[model samples]
Target: MKTSESLLAELARSGKPIGVGVIGLGAHGSWAERSHLPALRAVPGYELTALSTSSKQSAERSGQVHGVSRTFGTAAELAACDEVHLVVVAVKVPHHRELVRTALNAGKSVLCEWPLGNGLAEAEDMARQAQSSAVPTAVGLQARSHPALAYARHLVADGYVGEVLSATVVGSGGAWGATVGPRDHYVLDAANGATLLTIPFGHALDGLASVLGEPEELRIRTASRRTSAVDSESGRHVPMTAEDQVVASGRLPGGAVACFHYRGGMSRGTNFRWEINGTEGDLVLTAPIGHPQLSPLALEGGRGTSTGLAPLTVPEHYVRVPELDPRADAPAYAVAHAYQQFLRDLREGTSAVPDFAHGAARHRSISAGADRLAEGGRIVGP
Candidate 1:
């Protein structure tokens, strides 16, 4: 794991591309189909060599449609695939434990989609198995790898925004509200563990932390204002246990007070807005949609003597995957950056990839604060 060169050069030297096996890839429509598959295609050193679904027929159909020659009906079969160097687990939360452990036990590296497991214990178990396997692991927190966030962090560190004073973020949960499709019905139940607070807010938190560092103190308020959602398919209303609105305020590093608010579904007002103010100037990030992980964000800021906030174009060096147009699929673009980083880590033993340990840590942070928020907790210092 010490070789370092261009991806193609490294692949040429090894005489083979990095083989990736994807688990939980559905036959037709899925997040994996829309994001991971395209992300792998945009990346240079990896190929989708194998895929898995709930059944052999499904696996074959998915593999065939995606041009993957190998298909397996179960996680075990895919885990044992000799051609697979990395196992990408794209299944839902409840299934993350078994599939990730199976792949880790098989000695294959893994890239698990975010919220690594259904809960902290599950996430901890996955992280434990990963450590014992001694293989590279990555989580689905793509926001940490976004080029826009990277540029914003550089601006903060390079004195573009002198010692940060305060940061505020207001976001909307585009889908986890009013109603949901049959495929996404599971999210309405908090027990399913992929609610608005965990996925959208969790990713936004990741990006916020990456730019400002972890918070030292926090206050939170959360509520399930919309307790029911209509079933898009059945035309039935389902009771929801998960919170639809989240409000949090905290003191981050550099004594910056961070405030964040998110509500379920799209808002008539701004759907997404994150502002960082400092002694020198202020930076703002926005998008038409609320999910920063899935939507492209444009950066604008104003520094000393600047009349108004002007657009700041992200330069070329930070754009890791030029093949991915931010406008076309921002989520996939961010995902590709993480995938490319994992390939680099696999080659050079770097730690750029946010592994399951990071996943577990985030689970703890998100779950802990969310629990407190649900209880209407007040600000507390670490």
Candidate 2:
């Protein structure tokens, strides 16, 4: 396999935008249309060249709506297209492995959504494939690219909070609550891999781990508070086998105590709140929603002589992409940043963007916690 440096250099020399072919463009109200499409258009050095859907009709319709001419009904055809240098898998988690494998076999770079696969084995399989292919790969753990969180990571690294002592995170899954929509009912099944534990909690955990590092010792508990959820459109009760509440506490590698609690549905008070305390001071991040990758986060800090926490404005340079409407709060803001960083990584031969391997590592961590919960035991490690 050729080195990524050579591949990226060749692509850069082509003097053309990275052609992106997206799979799984839903009929409407899909994440691809709302986030990926907008982010792709806003970011430089990339173009939405092609798209694929479940059927020819939907593919063509989405192509027309999105102003793309190339459309295919299957991921394999899209991946084989010469105009597509990057293949984006935006479908559900169960289909991620197949689509990503198709792209990898076609020798195209891939950007698959988070929870890289349905579970650890699938994630590891794809990660191994990506490594063997030696192609640039990125996973949609976009929360790490959020400007505020990125800046907060820097602050923590720079010792703004001094010696870290502890951290706490509380968030809401928002969708795994008492109600489910017709389109989202699939997430209620743990076998499908898109659950409260994976989607919202997984994204938030990735963001936190990016800043504070991973835990060394961990204990977890999960519960399905609501046995079933009412389908909002059809008014039918959907059996929900997925856990709605997840709690985990552990010690970070740096010796900081960490605690996390995520529950189904939005809370009346705090939807998302994370606090980091140290010997010198404290830092806090708050968001209106639990998905930090989709929602904007506010950062506040108090250090040294400061007695009260004050809003800490992220430096403008942290957001390298062109400004979108509503700025940091825009749905595509963090995604665009992720794309920008990926572009830089390609051009500069850097591996800053979290890749398939990183996704697999995160899956291992989540699986360990889940296994502990399943075994009804605590996990202690160095």
Candidate 3:
């Protein structure tokens, strides 16, 4: 296996960029156009080659807007396109399986968004297929790829904080509380499998694990305070079955006590605050609102000799590419980091990129968290 260092040398030695085709580029104002488009254009070792949508007309429109001449009416066509080396699946969680399977069957690499599938079974099935296909794969899990997180991991390893004693995270769930639009109504139904717990909390947990090691076990308490949401598109009340709040406590793999609580909806209070206390010093990551993936995080640290925390800027060396926008907390900004890493991993044959196995690992943890929620906050081992 080539070390990441060797991969860097190899990439520097070769100048060709990886070709990517995005499935479900979405409509004019969707996340694909807003985030992925900008990100693909900004990253150095990537070239956007094709676009795919449900209809030929929509695909042509998106292709023209995005400057992708080769557009496909369906994912199967995109997957079989010779120009595309990597297939990016950004559609709804429910459609991930078929699209990803198509890409894999065509021997194309893929980068799928988080919650890899609608549920554990679906996620596992996808993971299993990805393994059998033997193609390089990546999950969105962009939070883990953030530069701030990269810096924190280095700091923790270097003992900026002597030994981690405990950590706590409190965050909000954005507009998932009481009101939602027709477009977002699907998320409110627990059966859809894209709920507050699965998306936001799951991403947050992965981010935490990226900085602090994964928790070996956890005990959880999950609840829903709102029984209904006003559908802004229909102007009617819709019954909601998804959870709006989750609280859990556990032990990190490194033996630090970890506590996490996520509340539904937007809040004026401390919307996102994560603190890690150590024997000698402490590190805190905070944001103005929830959705860590979309919120810029500021890192602060303090030691016993200091009266208060001080801003800690992430060193430029932690980032894979200096071309990436380090300022924005938006998806486009953060996701570029993972894209660069995926390209590097693809070129170098390294396992640094989070693949299907990694996604399945996270799914197991999430499934256990759900079980813990059901069983009255009891610890469950990995």
Candidate 4:
């Protein structure tokens, strides 16, 4: 196996594509088709060398669609293949720990979607494995990759927000978790319930921190206003072990107290907005909803009733985000970009954002909020 730096340098010098294998051909996997595969092809230094799925049908279908030559029935085969230099795990949450372990154990670079694991324990284990193996790894916290959020971070860091008074973020939508259909229905089940908080709020909260810096302490409340009725195909009422709605309060690392509201049970129009108030002025970002796939970005700041300005322009680090078919939003492309950066880091051996350790930290932050909320909203540190 090549060291990350050496691999990154080679990718830089070769000016060609890095061979990659994609594991898990479910909804996220399909995303790999529409987003990752195409983005890899377009990104200049990456290649989709192989594909894998648990069943032959999926492998065959995706292989035909993407023009992939080598296909594997399992991740182990994909990771062990000498033809692939990077392993992308877009599988279900329950399988993340194992698949990541397999790829790293095989001395291959790996990238897995967020929450790292279903809970804190799994995330910790994954972190430990990454540490022991010294393999380049990345998690799917894509919001930080956006230019709007980067501008927000710059403002906050520059004290333009003026000592960070408070921040409130609201993310509520019905169809937010898993899309209705045969596509990865397992995610809605309690066993697959990792998506509950981690999927929706995890991405949002990660963005929250990126804009506001780390949180010194936090408290969270999780409630199941409605139970998930199993889709007839799954044959069981997947207990909603995950919190359908969560509200959290905490202090930012800069000493700013913050309140957050997240709900996965919205049956009507969606509501996604975030506002931060500092001593001197306030900032509000609305629309573009929270999905990163949609590009451009709407920006508004400065005190007292100012309508948001369009094309406010963002930092260079903020990606313009490629367009996806379903037209999900910027978060979608932002996430894919994050994954691509991981691939770049692995192939080129450069340090990427939100590595396993960063992912583990975010997991701890959420876990801390959950635990504290259990105790009547007392502040707790992770």
**For this target, which candidate reaches the highest lDDT against the unseen true structure?**
2
In model 1, the runs with Cα more than 4 Å from the true position are 1-15, 372-382
| Per-model TM values vs. the true structure | 0.92, 0.94, 0.91, 0.83
Off by over 4 Å in 4: 1-5, 26-29, 173-184, 229-239, 267-270, 288-297, 303-311, 315-317, 320-332, 339-352, 372-382
Residues 64-116 of candidate 2 have per-residue lDDT tens digits of 88899999999999999988888999999999999999999988889999989
Candidate ordering by lDDT (highest first): 2, 1, 3, 4
Scored by TM-score, the top model is: 2
C-alpha lDDT score of every prediction, in listed order: 0.83, 0.86, 0.80, 0.68
Q: Who is ahead in TM-score, 2 or 4?
A: 2
Residue 338 lDDT in model 3? 80
Query: Which window of ten consecutive residues has the lowest lDDT sum in model 4?
Result: 373-382
Please list the Cα RMSD from the true structure of every candidate, rounded to 1 decimal place: 4.6, 4.3, 4.9, 5.2
Error of 4 at 278 (Å): 1.6
Ranked by lDDT, the better of candidates 1 and 4 is: 1
As for model 4, its CA RMSD to the true structure in angstroms is: 5.2
Candidate 2 clash pair list: none
